[model samples]
Target chain A: MKFTILINEGPYQHQAADSAYQFAKAALEKGHEIFRVFFYNDAVNNATRLAIPPQDDRNITVQWAELAEQNNLDMVVCIAAAQRRGMLDDDERDRQGKDASNIHPAFRISGLGQLVEGGIQSDRLITFGD
Target chain B: MAMLHIVNKSVFERGTLDSCLKSSLSGSSILFIEDAVVSAVNNTAVSDKIKAELSSKNFYVLTPDLNARGFTDADLIEGIKGVDYAGFVDLVADNSNVQSWL
Candidate 1:
């Protein structure tokens, strides 16, 4: 089965991100395809590379980046949400004349239409939120 | 395919329920869970909106959540069904996707 995962909360602040990551990992391990992982609301924070956690804590952003790298996952951060939360890729930063871009390379900024497309293309769309 | 939309916050507290209603496709199912159970009550400010949607969408309130919040079936708006956890699972299985408005 092809599944699309939606995450609606920022990392560490809520368990939604962790649960979504675990579900995505389990689905991949079970030999199921993950069509896309759509980050919306505060979840767009997960795609930022500037987040730094203490040495004792798990780095959620790194985990997602590594998972995406290993699986060649299509991890998308909603552009509207990302912009609102100050998460920007190089193109967005350049377009908006921002001084810096914090978005990790593993994730791409896209429109909400990608989320609608995920629902249309995937067999199941599972949402994890606050 | 139809979607199962879950609203976990009170309509009085947030616009999650309204957004869920607006985003829901025709023939989708809406389930009120957690604090959202408050919206199932009769005569609330949003009751008219809920009643209006009933003609096109299926409405359900989690029985445990309703009870936890000190509400009962009699407190619910007409056409709203109170369901158990098992029913929640069944609704998820019956729908093609799950969209939680948090």
Candidate 2:
């Protein structure tokens, strides 16, 4: 099946994001293609390239990056959400004259269009949060 | 089929998720919304159960509602996930079916 996942949480905070990860793994293992993974709202913060977690912490940013890299996944973040949470790519930061850019390379900053495209192109679109 | 699960109630609320999850699903999509997104918090039993079920099917969680309620993606542990409004619209469009929980 062609799968599109809408991840709504971060990797450390709770199970939502992580659950999406597990399900992604399952989909891939079952030979399902992951169309795209869209992050919105507070979940958009997961794209921060500068997230600093303690050594004992889960380090969600790195984890998500690694997973996306391994699977060649399309990790998307909502442009609106990222701006509200102070997460921005280099272009966005430069455009807005922000102090820095925090969105990692593994994730792309885009609008809800990607989400719409993913849902339309994929056979199944699964959301993992409220 | 396109289905949305709303996690509206807080994770701690009594029977909030249980009722939603166990509701009739003859052929409906479920998305979690509201405070229930809190259940995605790490080590939460609710997230565990929900994750397990989602692994076998095509259910998903929403993210904007959580953000509006002040919940961050970092608060989630393993199962819950995020989706945008466009994704929601696509789901409704892709599938000729629809239903809502609360």
TM-score of chain B of each: 0.97, 0.66
The per-model DockQ list reads: 0.20, 0.08
Best by DockQ: 1
Residue-level lDDT tens digits of model 1 in B1-102: 688999878899999998999999879999987678999999989899999999999999988779978989889999999987556655665787787887
- CAPRI class assigned to model 1: incorrect
Tens digits of per-residue lDDT, candidate 2, B59-93, equal 54556666766777666655445655545444544
Model 2: CAPRI class: incorrect
- In model 1, residue pairs whose N, Cα or C atoms come closer than 3 Å (at least 3 residues apart or on different chains), thus clashing, are none
Maximum-lDDT candidate: 1
The Cα error of candidate 1 at residue A28, in Å, is 0.4
Supply fnat for every model shown: 0.38, 0.03
* Residue-wise C-alpha lDDT for candidate 1, range A1-130, written one tens digit per residue: 7888889999998767875786687677767788999999999999889888999998999999999999999999999999988999999999999999999999999999999999999888878888
